[model samples]
Target: MQKLLIIDDNDEVRRQLKWGLSKGGYELTFARDGVEGLNMFKKQEPSVVTLDLGLPPHENGVEEGLRCLGEMLRINPLSKIIVITGNEEHGAALKAVQGGAYDYYKKPIDLNELKIIIDRAMYLQTLEQENQDLRDSSVADCGIVGECGTMQEVFTLIDRVAASDVPVLITGESGTGKELVARAIHAKGPRADKDMVCINCGAIPENLLESELFGHEKGAFTGANRTVKGKVEYAEKGTLFLDEIGEMPMSLQVKLLRFLQEMVITRVGGRRDIEVDVRIIAATNVDIQEAMQNGTFREDLFYRIGVVNIVLPPLRDRGADIALLANYFLKRVSAGAGSRGKAFSPEALEYINGYDWPGNIRELENRVKRAVIMATGPQIEPDDLGINGGDVLRQRLHANDLSLKEARMLLERDMVEDALKRESGNIVKAAASIGVSRPTFYDLMKKHGVRNA
Candidate 1:
C-alpha cells in the first residue's frame, strides 16, 4: 500500500485530511511541526507528503516548511512532497515548489482535487522506483549495458517475463546481442539449472536441419552409423534458443509446429513418440512479418514462438552507451594482449560517435580489438579504428543511390551525429547547435539511431 505523510500545525485540519485521504488507499501519518515532520518522514519513508507552509517555529512564514522539505528530499531525493499553503500565500507556495516540492496546494482543500494530484504523484513514484530497480538488476546480471529510456523499458520487460514459460521472440539486426539476451533470460529463469541448448538455424544445411533438431536413430539416414541425441532432446526441461529462426525451412517449421502442439517429438526413422518439455526462445534479424507474407515462414510457427517480442535496438541507437562499451572493450582487449593502458584518442572517439555502425556492437568490438593490437602508441587513432573523416563523407555520397526521402533522412542523421561529436557528446550543446529543443533533438537522435560519445 502507498504511504502519505501529513505535516500541519492545526489539529483540526490534520484530522480532516486524514479522514478524507483514508479512502484514497494510503496509510496516513501526521506530524505537528517541521522537526516532527522530518522525523516522521525519515521513519516512514512515505511515498507522498503533504507539508503545511506554516509550522510552529515560523507559523506565519514558509521558511520552516521549506527547510523541512529540503531535508526530507535530501534523505530520499525521490520523495513527492506536496506543499499546502494559505490562499493568499501564492509566492510562498510557488517558492515551496521551487524548493523541491513535487507540487503545491492552496488551503481550503477540496478532497477530490487533492486526491487526483496525490494519485498522479504516487504513480510517478512507482514508475521511477521500478525503473531504478530494473537498472540496478541490469547492471548486476543482464550483461547488457545502456541507459537510454527505451533500453530501460526493455530491461523492465525482461525482468517481468524472465520467470515465465511464455515463448520470447527477440527481433533485431545482426550483432545487437540477441544471443546475449537469450542467455540472460535463460539464466534468470526457473530453468537455469537445466541446459540451455542453442543452434544457429541459418548456419546449418537444409537437409541436416530436421535431424539436428530431433534425435536420429541408427541407420536413419546415409551416414547415421550411431544413435545421437539432437539439440531438442539435450535441452529437456530447459530452453531451446532458435537463432535466426526466420531462416528455418518451411518443411522443418511444420514439424516444429507439430512438436509445439503435442509436446512430443519423433526421431528420424523411429516410430516411437518421445515426450519433451522445453521452452522456446526464437531470434531473427529478418522481418518475420515479411517472411510470413512471402510464405517462407509458417504463420502458426510464428505465433507459437512470438508470444513476447523483445526488440533490441541497434548499437547506434544506444546513446552514450557507445563510449561505455568502447572503453569496456578497450580494457578487455588490451589486458589479455601485450598492450597496457591502451585508450581511444579524442579524434577516434569523435569518429566512433559520428559514424553509423552498420554492424553494431560486433563491429565496434572488432575494430577496438584490431586497434589494440595494431596501435603503435598508447592511444588508438581514427586510422587504427579503420575510419577516415573525409572518406566517410565520400563513402556516404557515393554509396547505393538513395531516394529523395532516404537522402534527406541520411543528411539529417549526419547533422545530428556531427552536432553530438562537436559538442563532445554534450546533449544541451548539441541541441543548441541544431536549433531545436533538447527533447526534440533527443527524439531526432533516437529516430536516426544516433549514439553519443
Candidate 2:
C-alpha cells in the first residue's frame, strides 16, 4: 500500500483530505506542521506528500514551507511532493516546484481533481524510488559503507585510479576496512570480472610466504609434492591484494620489488620466469614510514607499490557514521537471524558516541553482533556491548559534575594510558601509535601522572 502524507495547518482541510483520500487506495497520514511532517517522513518514508505553502509560525509566509521542502528533499529525494498554494500565490507554487517539489496546485481544493494529482504523484514517486534503489545497489555492490568526507575522497580516488592498472597502497588502522577498499577499487575497475587473489604477508610463515606468493615447483621443498600456482599467477589480468604488506620480510620485499618492476615471477627452485599481468593493491595497519625507518620495510618496494595511496580514517573520527553503520549492521544482522527488530537505548547511544572505538569499525560491528545475541530486552544497552557499561552509566549520572576542561583532561589521561598499554609501555611506540611524537607522548604521560619509566 502506498503512503500519502498530508502536511497542512488547517484542521478542516486535513479532515476533508482524510475523508476524501481515505477511499483512494492509499494509507493517508496527516501532519499539522513541518516538524511532525518531517518526523513522519523519516519514519514512514511515505511515497507522496501534500504540503501547504503556509505552515506554522509563518502561516502567512512561505518561509517555513520552503525550509520544510528543502529538508524533505534532502532526506528523501525520491519522495513526490505536491505543493498546495493559495490562488494569489501561484509564484510561490512555481518556486516550490523549482526547489524540488514534483508539482503544484493553486486555490481551493477540489477533492476529485486533487485525487488525480495525488495518484499521479504516487506513480511518479514509485518510478523515482525504483531508480534510486538501482543507484543504491550500484554503491552497495562495492561493499564499502561510508558517507564521511574522508571515505568520499577515497571513493573519488578509486574512481579515478581504477580505470588504470596502477599499484595502490591502502594504509589504515587494523580494523578500518582496508581490504574492503581494495576490493572496491578492483570491483569498480576494469579487472572486476577476473579473480582477486589475496595474500596476507603477516599471517603466513616467512619461509612459506615466498612459495605462497610466487608458486612452488614439484619437489621444490618437502611440502612441494606437486607444482602449485601462486597468488600472482592465479590473479592473472586481475587484482593481487597483499594484506599486511609491511610485514613482508626484507628478503621477500626484494623479490616483490623485482616482480613489480619486471611483471614476472620465478617459482621457488625454478629458473623459469613466468610472466603474469596483475594489478597490485597493498594494505598495512602499521605506519610504513616508521617501518622503513626501523629497517623492517623497504623504501624502494614502498614506492613501487604506492603509485596511488588511500588512507582510511578510523571510526572514531567519522562522527555520525557510527550511528549510520550501527543501524545498517543492526538491520542486516537482525534480518539474517529472523529476530525481532530492536533499537539501541538512549544511554547506549550516548556511550557509543562518547567512547573512542580504538579497534575501529570491526570492533563496533563485533560488539553490535554480540549485543544482538546477548541483549535480554528490546533495547541494547552499553552493557550489552561489553565495554564497561557500569562505568558509562555512572558517568552519565555524574555528567554534569565535571566541567568541560576537566572532562577533556580525564579523557586525555585515559587515552595516554590506553596507548601505553597497547604499545607495552614503550613511550616511543605508544606515541607513534596515536600519531604523536615521542616528546609529546612523554609530556602527556608526565601531565597525567603516568610514569615514563
Candidate 3:
C-alpha cells in the first residue's frame, strides 16, 4: 500500500487528515511535530508526506516545518511533500513550495480536494521510480557489466553525457570496449530512436574517407555512377560514431571540424552545402595527446569533439571485474550457442583472476565464446580458455596443504605481489589493479615482508 505521512502538531488537524486520507486507499502515519514526523518519514519511506507549516514549538511560525521539509527532501529528493498552511500564512506556503514541497494546501482543508492532490503526487512518484528502474535495467542489459569503482564512474558519466547534445570522445586501449560505451550513450540518449551511423576512420583508406563521410556526387570519382548519401547525411537527427577516430587523416580533420562548428556538410564534387543535425561520438585507442603533438591530429578538432571525454580503463586495472565479466560472457555465449549452460572450473576462475588481460573485454569475450565451442565437459577449464598454467595460486595452495587461514593469507600475499609485479611496482596502480586502497596495499606488503624495487 502507498504510505502517507501527516506531520501536523494539532490533534484535531491530524485526526481530520487521517480520517479523510484513509479513504484514499493509503497506509496513513501521523506525527505531532517535525522531529517525530522526520523519524516516521525515514521509517515508513512514504511516497507522499503532508507537512504542516504551523508546527511546534513555534506553531505560529513556519521554521520548524520548513526544516522538516528540507531534511525529508534531502533524504529522498524524489519525495512528494505537500505542505499545509493557514490562510494568513500564504507567503509561508509559497516559501515551502519554493523549498521543494510538492504542493501547498491552505487552511480549511477540504478532504476531497486534498485527496486529489495527494493521489496525483503519489502517481507521479511511482512513475519517477519506474523510470529510474528502467534506466538502471537498460544500462545493465547493454553488456557493460562491472561493479568496480572505475566502471561505476564510467556508467555515471555515460548517464550524464547521454542527456546532452555535446560531442563525446571515448579513449582507451585497444579492445577495451570503447565502442560499447559509445553505443550505451547513444542507446540511452534522446536520439536513440534514430539511426546510429558508425564509420571506422582507420579501417577505411585515406583516399576515400572524405567521400565516405560527406557523400560523393555522380561521376565525382572514377567509379561514381550515381549520387549517394554519406554517413553524416544518414545520421541526420541522430548520432554518428567514429570508431578509431585517432586514425582519421589530417586532411579530413579540418573538414570534420568545419562541419562540427557549422553543422553543415558539402558532398564531394557537389556545390550544395547540406545542413545535417547529428551528434558525434568518437572513440580511439591511440593516445590523442601524442597524436596532436606529432601534428597528425588537429588540436582544435580534438577540443571540438572532446567537449566530454570518457576514458575506459584497461581490463587488468579493473580488479574483480575481470572475473565478473568472464562469467557474464560465459553465461551469455553458452546460452546463445544453444548449450545447456557452462560454468568455469575453480582452476579456470583462479586463472581468470590471475592472468593479465592485455586485450581487455574484447579478449575476454572472444575467449569465452571459443571455450564454449571447444569445451567437451560441462565446466570450462583454463586450457579451454587458451591460458595454460595461469592458475599458479591454486597450485601453490594445493601443494602446501595449509590451513584455511594460512591459505587465505598466502593467496592475499601472492595476489599483492603479482599485482605489484604486473604494474611494475607503481603502488597506486598496483593497489587499484587488485581492488584495494593504497593504504591496504601498503599493509599487505608490510605483512608479507614484500619489497618493491
Candidate 4:
C-alpha cells in the first residue's frame, strides 16, 4: 500500500484528512507541526505529503510549511508534496508550487478532489522509484559483487570511458562478463536514456548479416517481403553493441566501414542515404588481429573499432575473484530457487579457487546456479559442485605430502602440456594460446625441464 503523510497544525483538520485518506486504502500518518512532519517524512519515507500553510508555533503563516516542503524534497527529490492554503493565502500557495510543490489546494478542502490529486502523485512517485531501481540493478560493478584489485581497475576504466563518446572494444575469453561490461558503459553513458541495441555477428548467417546491419527496402531480396529498419538505424542517437564481431563476414566489413566513416547508410535496393548518430561498441573472444592477417577480417575495420580497447582478464588469472563471484551467484541463484539460505562449503570454495576455469565467469555462475538447486543442505559441498569429490579427499589425506616447489612444478607441467595440445605443439601459437608471452612460455618450459616438442 502507498503511504501518505498529512501535516496540519489544526488537530481537527489533521484528523479529518487522515480518516478520509485512510478509508481510501492509503497507509496514513499524521504530524501536528512542521518539525514533526519533517521527522515523520524521514522515518516513514512516505510517497506523498500534504502540508497546511497554518503550522504550529507559526500558525496563520506559510514560512514553516514552505520550509518543510523544501526539506522533504531534499530528502527525496521524487517525493510528491501538496500544499494546503486558506482562501486569503492564495499567494503563498502559488509560491509553494514555484518552490517545487506537486500541486496546491484552496482551504475548505474537497475530499474528493484531494483524493484524486494524491492518487496521481502516488502513481508518479512509484514509476520514478521503479526506473531508478532498474538503472541501479543493470550495472556490473554496481551489481557484479567483486572488490578485487583487477575488478576495481575494470570498474575505474568503465567509469572513465562512460563519459566519453569514443567507441569501446571489449576483448576477452567467452563468458568473462563482456556483455556486463558493455552494459555498464551504456548505463553510465550519456546515451543511457536511449536504446542499447545488441547484435550477435556470429549468430546470424553471412547472407543476412548485411541486411541485419543495414535495413532493406521492400522486395530487395527473395525474403524481403517488406521494408525493415536494421539494428544500426533502430539505434539512432543511441548505442549499438556488436558481439563476436570477429565472426562478421568479409562481405559486410566494407559496408560497416562505410557506415562508420560516413555516418550514413542506404538500405538495400534503395537510393536515399539515411543518417544516424550511433555509438558503436563491439566485443569478441577471437583474435581479431590474427583474423585480419589470415585474410578473413579487414585491417582498416579493426583499427577503426579498436580506438578504446578493454581486454578483460579471464577468471583464472583474476586471483580470489572466483570466491567472490561464487558467493555473488550463490545468493542470486538461491533466491531464485526459493531455497534455504545457501552457502559454499570450505571444500567447495577451495576447489573453485583451484580450478582452471577455462570458461571464465560464465562457467562459475552456471556451477553455482546448479549447486543451489541440487544441494540438499544449506551448505553446498564439493560433491554437489561436480568437481570430483575423490580428488578433494585424496588431497586432504596427503595435505602434508607435497612440498611447495613440487606442487608448483606439477601445476606448471599440466598447464604447459595443455597449452601445447591446444596449440598443436607450435611454441608461438602455444604462448598466445595460453595468454602468455613467448619469453614467459620459454622460461616455464626450462623451469619444468620439459623438452619443446
lDDT of 2 by residue, 249-339 (tens): 9999999999999999999979998999999999999999999899999999989999888999999788787876776677667767888
Better of 2 and 3 by lDDT: 3
Q: Each candidate's lDDT (Cα)? A: 0.84, 0.84, 0.86, 0.82
lDDT of 4 by residue, 349-428 (tens): 76677666778898888888777766775678765676653343336337664446446545765687678888878999
State residue 27's C-alpha deviation in candidate 3, in Å. 34
Per-model TM-score on C-alpha atoms: 0.58, 0.62, 0.58, 0.58
Measure candidate 2: CA RMSD: 14.8
Candidate 2 backbone collisions, by pair: none
Q: Identify the runs in model 3 with alpha carbons over 4 angstroms from their true place.
A: 1-140, 390-453
Q: On a 0 to 100 scale, what is the lDDT of residue 408 in model 4?
A: 59
lDDT of 2: 0.84
Give the per-residue Cα lDDT of candidate 2 at 131.
43
Alpha-carbon shift of residue 125 in model 3 (angstroms): 32
For model 2, the run of ten residues with the poorest summed lDDT: 388-397
Best TM-score among the predictions, by candidate number: 2
